[model samples]
Target chain A: MLETLNQTTFLHTVVAIGSFTIFTIGLVGVLSKKNLFKIFLSLSIVESSLFLFFIGSHFEVGKAAPIVADGIKLFDGHMVDPVPQAMILTTIVIGVAVLALSLTFVVNYYRLSGNIDIDKMDELGEVQ
Target chain B: MFNFEITALGNMFFGLTVLVFVSLFFVPNKHRSVTLYSLLFASLACIFYASDLITLFIGWEIMGWSSYFLIAKTADKQTLQKYIVFNIGGAFTLLGAIILIYGACGSFVYSELDFSAVPSGQVTAITILLLLTLFVKSGIMPFHYWVVDSYSQSNDLFSAVLSAIISKTGVFAFILIFFQIITVQYLQTPILEVVAWLGVLTSIIATFKAINEDEAKRLLAYSSIAQVGYIVTILSIMGSLSLEAALYHTVIHTFVKLLLFINVAAIIYVSKQHRFSTLGGLLYKYPLNFILLVVGIISLAGMPPLGGFSSKFLIYTALLEEHKGLLLAAVLFSSASAFLYCYKLVYGIYLGQPTNPKTEAYPRIPLRFYVPQILGAVILITLGTIPGVIVPMFNGILGSVGFEPVLYRGVFVLGSDFASFNGGVVIGAFGLIFVLILLFFVRLKNRSVKPKDRLDISYCGEVPRADVNLHYGYGMGRELSRIGLIKMILSRSSHALWQRVSTLFGDLSGITQKLYTLSAQNMGLVIFAFFTILLYMGVK
Candidate 1:
């Protein structure tokens, strides 16, 4: 029984490592990407990794989804921590708000300036 | 309806009422004025009676949005967008902090959150977040980008409200942040120390920039930032002396800045110009505005016995007590720089020879212009003479925040020495002496003194020519803005920081566009590699 538990811990560590590597790939894509739409979608991918890590790290052997049903009781030992989940919900909302706002700014900027390449904007150049 | 414990609720509701009615109705200047006046009263009411963080935040958000709409009426939508975004950033930061605290303690009641009860890390986080929000709203360094851009573009009346009352909400927010939510014991780290240092640096740098600013509104914007920097430094000290010093500054800075901005607004209104090059010799015609602005500038310089001096004196004392050696030096340097800009503001635009060939101005201003100036000027003088009345008031404000209330009347009071006076007594004496001299000159009646036109300043080897556009206001103190330290911190252009951020965004988009260049076989290889890595990780 103890050996199985130890093996489970090592497996969890491996999963964590793999997930982190995927996260790095997504981050690299985000940093290197130049298209407005693609950059935003890359950010979405990054958010997904975070959600997976959060939900996955809380997983335990034989544990089930953290919700109540006919058989599953509230606050059962089989369920994961509720606090991180609630926090992630708030984080998701805030993230969405910020993303929407920034995209709107981008859209409006495109509408006004015609060119979205920030490298091209020199309306107010640095004073010597 | 909920039997609210917050007295500020009624006032906030009243402000919203005005905001609603004004937005719906055509509300010509009279209706606008009445609504603005009522909103002003409502804000003042909110200032007095805010109970908890929730109530305070409500009042605070209301003030910002109302002022935003008011300024939006004047500025283009882009300027309005910048204004709204910056303010919302501040509001949301405050909200995030309050929510965080509430989550920790399961309570929204600010009065119940004892500074000693919370973990130090939580306290630190809360204070830092609150400071960042307030600093931005107050237009402190680094976060001061929105100020000059939006302020210069906003309408005159809305700009006045923005300069005077709207900015004070940040001060109000700071009072709560520093005095109520934070304790010196809790701030074991030197966060407040950093804030103090930043404050001094902000003032010094911004003051240097102000001396060289060309636009009247932009100059006032820089000057306002510098003044607020001083107040922020004093508040961060958290001692009784510093807190009182800050509040005194809050009142005085409001009065002096309001007086200056309104007079400048009047100039823009009358002359229909904003650049100094187009303005000169206003003192010859609008003497009341000239006098009020001159006094206002004098107060701004912290000249003895004026409203400016009283608060500045307290600030110097607070610095002395703390023995903030470098900070003190910065304060003195900024104060000295005040002379360059203040002189330029007074002499270049108002006193110097008019450069315009068409030198005649609109000869006079209406009562609307004069009334605001008088109200602002009177408050400056009154606050300077009897700051004793507000000393307890500051203490009361501090007390509400849960910090130790600063005693205003004690022997340790700053700037009480004759050297750092409000200059009220001396100014009065000077006025009397001037009157007596004028009388003597009148009684002798020997030499006739002709009133010279502003365009008639005697130039080299030439008589005063009517065709000469002397252009007295051009290039006054522009060189003073070249202070390397200030230039480094201040946005180099009107669109400096925002432009960079926007560029970075564009570059990001550009880079993202390149990702689709890969072949379908390469993409399959990537997928194969990914699954192989996953398998390897699981087996390991």
Candidate 2:
């Protein structure tokens, strides 16, 4: 039963469902939260789900990591594709940096105006 | 990256730029910046000499922004806004056309452009876009919303530059891009005819508007628009003679505007007044300025024995050659109406009784101001004396642009096989009559009594009150509004049309603004919804 469940299609299905569930949770948090900080945190959670989905969908059982190490002396088709993983890693780094910067802005904004609720922020003024 | 070449057209424009810029040097203005002016001149030269669309656009943008800064020194916020908006819109259209051409031909260079590969539809689109750009620059009507405000609100000296040099850039580009690069083979005659009508109509309306203007600079601004309109009309004929006619008018107008603007600037400098109501009897105070202004107005009105007439004659002949009888009649109607405003200009400032008490205390105009006026006056007179003198230069330009040179016998005669005139004879006859009149007046005058009090003369056989404003300048063109056709023309304005366009844009942007809420929750919902749609699309 374990051997049968470990099929490529089954793994991809599991990855998709799990990531979709996590993404939905994050989307609910983002939509329900009024606080800017909470919303940003939720956005990060959504980003992580996307990363998991991209990486898991590209992964294959019994495939070597895309690197020339140990038993893998040379690059070959036996290894999983690394481009999507590499792209996700860059995206994660950028996402973290942006999230940190935006949280800092929220902190400073709350200190100045004594509020972090994005709903209450009318600094751009009411649109005519 | 930018390429430039000195064609005969470029050289002619450069020469005109030098003449105008030199005259600008003698103009006294505390706000004047040598750096900005130099930048302007260099950019203008770059535009005139540009061998590619890229270089032309770069120079065009530089010209626009630099002129904005120059005008910003004296213009109000509204005027500056108008100037920037119209000019930038024009520049963007030009950029779009250039991009379209580049996509079609795979090159920005004029010589590399192979329009044969371009679809006729795309060619028309490019032509229209380029024409729109030229129209805005030249302050052609409907696109001329910024012209009056910018010209009048700018410093007196800079106004001359704006009118004389800057406006001509449009004419140059029109000639350069249309005649040389695009070449008239791709152009449709109906489009040319429509342009001709637009030109004549603009002149007619602008002439009436000039008559309505009480301020001197504003009046001259409208006149500048009207004069450029004539050039546009003549140019639309698209023949060797029409091109020559347009070129002649361009040259004459440059000098005419320079002379008139500088003359007005001098008057403003001494009197510290711009309105005609407050300015009168200045002929005796600044006789030289007055005389120079008279010469300018004569040329402006396109009378005989002036450079204006030579160009006007050419324009009429060009129109006749095209068998555009109705258009010629309309142009003549506009030209005839132009005389009313020209007379109003002279009568308001120089011929009437002094309206302001301070006129008696006005000081002598600086000698430097006369330099440009004299230069302009002498050039106009010379051109009037020898109409065909500039023909060789124009012929060179025509030849360079791949057109046959218009026929001309000598420097004294102008025109082709269709019609011709002896400039020398016209000037000589006028000069002789002028001398005889002067001699006759000088010998027979002495019976005229000088009024002790200007209001002492009984008006309608009743003594008018001291406070009564009798300056006819105020009421000069008010009657034109009462006339049926002119009233219809005067009633419509481009301002209302532009205002409606702005409001429409405002409403459109307002719709998009609704989605840009600051609420993080709402923004998150939008993002989530957008992502879901993308995901669904991908999955499908």
Candidate 3:
């Protein structure tokens, strides 16, 4: 059953469903969180779900990592598609950068306005 | 990927306007300002030469930001805010249109946009979006909220460039997008009709606004809108003659604004004043500048023996050729009404007696200030005397853009199937008549009345003091407000419409903001609910 679960179609379906569920949870957290920090973390969670969906769907059972090693004989379908993994790696770095930058903005906002709750933040002077 | 192609239309506009930009270098400005100015020139060149939507967009964005920074140097925060918001909105609309075009054509290249394959409805939608961008850039009614403030607030010399050169970029874009990429055959008829009406309406409204404006630059700014309105209207007609008319008007309006603005800038530079209330009796102090401004306003009013008349005549002829009777009437009305403001512009600054006592103490205007004014004057005079000089160039532009060449009869004459005019005769008759009057005036010098005391003007039982406000410039246009139509036009503002739009956006943003303020548990529940909805949709 475990081996069957690792099959290509089965694994891809499971990853799609699981990552989508994670994305939904993050989306809900982002929608409902009062704290700026929680909202940003929730956004990061959503981004991670996207990365999982990209990388996990490309994985194949019994395939070697896309690296040249003593056991790995040739560069072919025997190795899982490496493009999605490479893309995910770049995406993760960007995600982290964005999250870090946003958090800094949030910190600055908190210091300046003294409120982490987005509802209470009105530095732009918008009418309620 | 980057691609640029040269067309005669681009050459005509860029070649003429670049001279204005190059002339700015002669005017003293900060090094950084010069750098920004050059950047704007390059971006405009990019826009004119761009063969692909991506390149066009990049240039459009650069032009927007560079102009923004240039304006921000002197503009107040509110003015800067208005400029950025409107320009960014225009840029986003342009981006959307480009993306939509790319989706339909599967390529960014203008040459490859095979709209025949796309559905007509989609094409119309894309055209409307593209038009929205052009409308905002051109400062048409409803989208023109930023123009008056930005023009009034920018550095004086840059205001000349803004009105003379930068505004024409929208005209260039209209020619490029509507005529070239989305050829006339593909455009829906009713939409073009609507565009034509919008242009004429903008002109009528802007003319009134211009007349009522006390601030000199703001008046000129409104005049620029009104002038471009005619171009837009003619362009919407999309005939060979109409295109020529639009191009001619574009060229004429550029020089007219350049001369007028720089002339005002010189006055402002000397007197340190921009309002009509404070500026007067400047004719004797700066006679050369005064004459140049007179020439400018004459041409701008489209009176004969000036370059303005040639273009205006061409425009009227084009409208007649199209049998657009109502449009012709409306345009003629606007053109006639323009004479009042033209008179106001001149009388406000040069004709009226000096209002302030310190007017006599203003410093001499620098010689460098006269360079651009002189260049502009020479060009206008040449175009006025030989209006046929640009006909071939206009024809070349038309041919390159795949439009039929307009009929040309002689070196000094321009005509279509309907009517024609001789620029040489117009200028010759006017010059001879003007010289005769001047000679007669000079010959009768002995008949001149003796000069009276400066403060000897008659008053109703009260002698007016030196400090009394005797200048008619301040109240020149005030009585125009008594007219019902003029009163209505002056009272209405586009600001309320834009405010409504922003308020709607604010409300939408308020709802979205709430999503970020919910508790953690509620967020989790919302997430589950969203997931369940997505799953159900997927299953269905």
Best candidate, DockQ: 2
What fraction of the native alpha-carbon contacts across the interface, defined at 8 angstroms, is recovered by model 1? 0.00
Give per-residue CA lDDT, model 2, range B182-267, as digits (tens).
Answer: 88998877778888888988899999999998999999999999989998998888899999999989999999999999999998
Where is model 2 more than 4 Å wrong at Cα?
Answer: A1-26, A35-128, B507-517
Provide the lDDT at B450 for model 3. Answer: 41
- Tens digits of lDDT, candidate 1, B1-540: 011243322233234234323332321232265565566556545643565667666766776776766666667765776677778888888888888777666666656666666787887788777887888788888777787777788776556556665666667667665665555677754887888888888888788778777788888888888988998888887777787788778777776776787788778776788888778777778888888997798789987656787788788887888787778888989998898889878876787667664558364666566665676688677656654555655665556445565454432233433223334465576568879998998988778544466544344576655655566457666454475655564446547567677679878877766555444334545776798899999999
Model number with the top lDDT: 2
| Runs with alpha carbons beyond 4 Å of true place in candidate 1 | A1-128, B1-48, B361-363, B398-459, B462-469, B481-491, B506-540
Q: What root-mean-square deviation over C-alphas does model 2 reach?
A: 4.6
Score each candidate by Cα lDDT: 0.69, 0.89, 0.87
TM-score of each: 0.68, 0.87, 0.78
Question: Weakest 10 consecutive residues, lDDT, candidate 1 chain B?
Answer: B1-10
Angstrom error at residue B476, model 2: 1.3
TM-score of the candidate numbered 3? 0.78
> What are the candidates' individual DockQ scores?
0.02, 0.44, 0.07
Checking candidate 3 for backbone clashes, the offending pairs are: A31-B515, A32-B518
